[model samples]
Target chain A: MAVILITGGARSGKSRRAEMRTRAFPGQPVYVATAEALDTEMEARIAKHRARRGADWIEREVPLDLVGALVATDGGGARLVDCLTLWLSNLMHATRDWEREVTELAAALPRFKSPVVLVTNEVGLGIVPDNALARLYRDAAGTMNQTIADVADEVEFVVAGLPMKLK
Target chain B: MAVILITGGARSGKSRRAEMRTRAFPGQPVYVATAEALDTEMEARIAKHRARRGADWIEREVPLDLVGALVATDGGGARLVDCLTLWLSNLMHATRDWEREVTELAAALPRFKSPVVLVTNEVGLGIVPDNALARLYRDAAGTMNQTIADVADEVEFVVAGLPMKLK
Candidate 1:
């Protein structure tokens, strides 16, 4: 069993890189997408991403409650959590239960049986945003990354379509 | 002489990490800031950042012409280019020959006598932006980072307040 955490800056090809690493595991793949189409633009983006996947893979559109989504996956199945940052953003905008949700999300990663690769956006290197909400999201994402990276069996930082192992 | 490129997601402590790495060099330091305070919020941010630095640094507030800014530094001065993304953004908004400017900027690195640390934000790891300008900026930043990282003697990716050497 492997819990691989993949992180990188926006559009650094993190999702493609994360998916590539999951190929070593022998099972029907599960793509656990954490994005919701709140707007037409986002819906189009989601549709574009979804169209690129292989036909046989199972898809789970999980906006939040990642713990519950993970519980339903097969232990031997290769599960790809397309991203965690968006889910964090979703929670940040919704009810103020993000801390509890993040803790539960971290605790649930260990329950997977085979290989599970997680994709998380690295958004902390730019100027600190002027708004309080953006800062809160940044802090929350950083904390979640550290927590997941700690428990991950492998960690990689993707840049310019390449993967640099961090742990 | 050493050309070091430092990159990370926004607010990932890339700037501070870059300045810290330059401490080993024995020379007067240069902090070449590429940001322009076009608005009140930005002006406040710039003032706050400037307040954090010690008085000894040779501060060069160069907004667009990075190559010219570097050319003015002392040969042995420890140059810390606080950022490249804002410079790129500024160029995008301005009517100027950016390609030529970038070429010159890359060519100026070898002329430095001591360590020169360049900090850049990785903005390509998130969803593809819905707007054209954002997409253009993202692509431009990625290209610029790759361009610098190629010529730099060393490159590092910072995350969650930690530095991980990439090359």
Candidate 2:
């Protein structure tokens, strides 16, 4: 089992790159979407991603319980967790202990029998947000990224549709 | 002379990396600062950077007119533009034509006799900003980065105090 982390800024082609990596592995690909189409903006974005990723993937909308979803979908093809940031947001919104959830996911990643490619955003690279919540979220996001990247077998930082290997 | 672009998220150690690059060139390194300490938060950050950078280098505070400043300091050692994001924000606040300024800077970079090391932020990697102004700024920052990167001889994306060469 291989745990690969792909991190980048918004629209940096991280999802596309992760899709390519996930497809390179054998078996039917799994698209573990952490995003739920809550609004038109999100719906449109999800549609766009699906259109590009094709319909062959076994899609699973696992917004919060990512570890459980991955566990249930084990022994299959590569699992591409389209993102972890949104999952964090969802956990926070649901009043779940995000830190614990993130830790659990990191702990479970190495034990998986199938390949897992996780996509994440680099949110803390910009100007500090004015609101305290945004600040907290960015900090949490950065910490989560570091933790996952540390546990992964490989890590890549993407920019302008290019992936620069970090590990 | 080489034009190098170092980009990353907030607190990603971009300044340290840029400083090392600037020192690699011969002569007294010039620190071209685009930041103005208008508030306590900024003042603290500026102080920290100055402490790390040391007082041995020649420093210039040029929030706007970066191209002119670079041209004026042509024969000096490598000029490190501490950041382009603040410069962009300053231009936007001053009602200056930022796109034109960025274009001019890009065009003028190759002609500089001194090596130039620029630091910039990747603001668009996180979730879409709730405010329209932040969104516009992030979009502008992204475009500016890509434009500058296209002209840069070397481009590096820093993450968690690590630099990953993009070019």
Candidate 3:
């Protein structure tokens, strides 16, 4: 299995770029979503995303156990994790052992049957949060992205919807 | 059902307070975790939270279909959703229609057979984000908390581990 990690700031068009990259793979692509719509505006936001993705991708809304989903779908075609920051945030909000899950994901990647493209936001460039939770999220996502990058066969940083290969 | 919404910054003791408040309710209290550990530090953090929660609470890790889980667990006992911001973040990351889930949650609240304590972070109090996605998350979460508060029987804001009843 081959793993690629993608990172960029919010709305840098990382997801769109990741989508385009994943479609090049030989098999049908699977999109693992980590978002939950909680309001009207969010409803509209989700609608926009759906309109963009269309119906080609087999979508799985695995917000919490992305690792498990990734492992299960490892043999499928190409797999794209839309964003890791939201996944990290979800981990912080509910589970206590988010680190273990990350570890498991890293360990399981090489064994997976399909090529993987992991999408995440680079959160360290921003100012330190004033509160504990924000700070925790910032640090955690930063570290998680770093770990994924370290293991990934390719690392790309997106800027203004442009992808720049770092490794 | 007696529904209360808790809002706070990270580590402001919202979880602790939610736990304490739910302790007042009879029967087994349920902790609906939305987190997925993806790294070492996050694993440690999850472990710490687990230690604090002990084995008394029946834990259900529901990262995506939270409203459905809430619906299924309604009559079981008191339910505590550790945080809404993370839930919303998950929705935003995965699907485009996170608002549908929010509306479903709001609609499901009154029919809950047990008291529900919905916890969320007050992220909008801080400065606006520099990008579109961050700004979207902030705006969506803020609006979500407000909508949940409007429906809750009691609403509280937590700062530095202290809770101030807002409504």
Candidate 4:
């Protein structure tokens, strides 16, 4: 019924807020995780998150091809993409065209029949990165956020584990 | 007349929002900068900000002794402390009692009769810092923000160059 975008820095309650929003919809909830357990710490973190989510959620891990997976859903229930930033990072490492991908995702969002609560991290709010790659990633993340926010029906900023609705 | 908490990451339009808020009050605006230009890059950034602020502001560079500097103000005009994180960093480096200082600052806030706009950064939203010092700094920043936000009349979170009022 709506597209909600929740963005904040790492561990800013964006995911928790997005998870809670899924309850407002009908049928089972879909949890699309963009993060890959590439490292031991990350694997542990992912497990912890999944544990918190419980068995009720239909979990799908999509490191790439996010748009395809999202669109492939039957629009049967509320879908929560645990994060777009990690997905963006995955795409970045794959040397894919991020701009085109972002454009595609934003364009495809409104077509979803059920509400899709998206979680994302805003990483560009820190000091100007010291390296070129970090700077490039920061710029891409900022643009990606703007593109998605422009289309989302509701946008929020999380601070200190609190959600502040922006739109 | 009000205490507005402006919290965001670096370069997130926080300073700009704080600057605009200063216009709503009586008398001149006071700019309390806690950042010390210890490096060439920092010096350049400080100069750029000072130029943007223009010559009208009564600029006070308070690297430490934030509460004292604040209390010493004549309670006239809008006061902006364009970041508490920097001040905290200064205290952290000095091995001072930051918790006590934070408590004192919060206690002293209500005494400022006119509007006081405070700027701060949120550094805890990312992955757990790889280093102990970074982690400590991040935790300190979060606690400090909460301490001040609890006392402030209003709090806003800025993301993607926009502000969302939280209180």
* Candidate 3: segments with Cα more than 4 A from true spot: A1-167
Output the better candidate (1/4) by TM-score.
Answer: 4
Which candidate would rank higher by TM-score, 2 or 4?
2
Q: For model 2, which pairs clash?
A: A9-B125, A10-B124, A10-B125, A125-B9, A125-B10
Whole-model lDDT, model 1: 0.80
Give per-residue CA lDDT, model 3, range B1-167, as digits (tens). 79999876555467878988887899899998887676785678778888998899988888788988888888877998876877887888887587777887888897888999888877765456777788887778878877788888999765334456789
The parts of candidate 1 lying over 4 Å away from their true place are B1-121, B124-132, B143-167
* Residue B121's lDDT in candidate 2: 89
Best by DockQ: 2
lDDT of 3 by residue, A1-167 (tens): 77888777777898888888888898899989888886798679667877998888888987799878887887779999877888888887886588887877778777788999888876544333657777777657755765676678887778789877666
lDDT, each prediction: 0.80, 0.91, 0.79, 0.84
lDDT of 3 at A21: 82
TM values, all candidates: 0.59, 0.62, 0.52, 0.61
The candidates, ranked best first by lDDT, are 2, 4, 1, 3
> Model 1, residue B69: displacement in angstroms?
21
**Top-lDDT structure, candidate number:** 2
* DockQ of prediction 2: 0.25
Root-mean-square deviation of Cα positions for candidate 4 versus the true structure, in angstroms: 6.3
TM-score of chain A of 3: 0.94
